[model samples]
Target: MVSTTTTSTTSSQTTRERVLACMRDFTSYQATRVALYKEFEEL
Candidate 1:
C-alpha cells in the first residue's frame, strides 16, 4: 500500500543520514590524526 511505501522511504532517508554522519566523523578523525603527525614531525 501507499503507507508502506512511505514508511520504507522514510527509513531509507534515516539510514542515508546516518551513513553521512558516520562518514563525516571518520573524515574528521583522520584529519585530526594527520595534524597530530605533522606536529610531531615539527618537533
Candidate 2:
C-alpha cells in the first residue's frame, strides 16, 4: 500500500510537469504566430 502511494505521487508530479511543458510550448507557438502575422501585415 505504501508503494502504491509513492507511485501515484510520482505520477502526479510527472503529469504536472508535462502540463507545464505543454503550456510553455503553446505560449511560444502563439508568440511565433503573432510575429509572423505582423510581418505579413507590414508587407
Backbone clash count for every predicted candidate, in the order shown? 0, 0
Give the TM-scores of the predictions, in the order they appear: 0.80, 0.82
Query: Positional deviation of 4 in candidate 1, in angstroms?
Result: 12
User: Compared with the true structure, what per-residue lDDT tens digits does model 1 show for residues 1-43?
Assistant: 2445467788888789999999999999999999999999999
- Output the number of the TM-score-best candidate: 2
lDDT of 2 by residue, 12-43 (tens): 88889999999999999999999999999999
lDDT (Cα atoms) of all candidates against the true structure: 0.90, 0.90
TM-score of 1: 0.80
Q: Model 2, which residues run further than 4 Å from truth?
A: 1-6
Screening candidate 2 with a backbone cut-off below 3 angstroms (N, C-alpha, C), the clashing residue pairs are: none
Q: What TM-score number comes out for model 2?
A: 0.82
